[model samples]
Target: MAYDVQSAKTWSPGDNAFYLIVEGTTQEEIKEYWEQLITDGEILQPLAPSQWSPLYGMLKHQFGVVWALSVLNDASPM
Candidate 1:
């Protein structure tokens, strides 16, 4: 099977380099997962969260990809 390029966005210094963002159930688990990804060299740099209301983090992956993972509340999807 072959896939066609849908859309490609240019990268800028201000733009995060994340390609994949995986959401976890809890903030703690998300942090742990982020650390694990770093340990495995999946992410290069993890950004500092500017706000506490939303649990967010940024990391540069080994593949030169950047990712942002967020832990949403259980009722968020609903």
Candidate 2:
């Protein structure tokens, strides 16, 4: 999905205004993808356990896109 960062006063380009979530079945799967995205980019939040999932993190890709990666764990509803 996408968003118009200009319309959101709290967000701007290169920020976590829009997140492309990529959920995996295992923490290793998520972590691997997270590592690939962080290259030449920035990490908004380090991968770690969260209330919603076993492993979760947010990061900006090298191409200025944001992403939210997580492991599909029991804690998560979907």
RMSD of each: 6.8, 3.2
Give candidate 1 misplaced runs (Cα > 4 Å). Answer: 1-18, 40-53
**Structure candidate 2, residue pairs in collision:** none
What are the runs in model 2 whose C-alpha is more than 4 Å off?
A: 1-9, 13-17
Per-residue CA lDDT of model 2 for 41-64, tens digit only, reads 998889998888889998888988
Using alpha carbons, what is the TM-score of model 2?
Answer: 0.78
lDDT (CA) per prediction: 0.57, 0.81
Q: Give all TM-scores, in the order shown.
A: 0.53, 0.78
| lDDT top scorer | 2
Q: What lDDT tens digits, residue by residue, belong to model 1 across residues 3-37?
A: 22225755554444335666667778788878776
TM-score of 1: 0.53
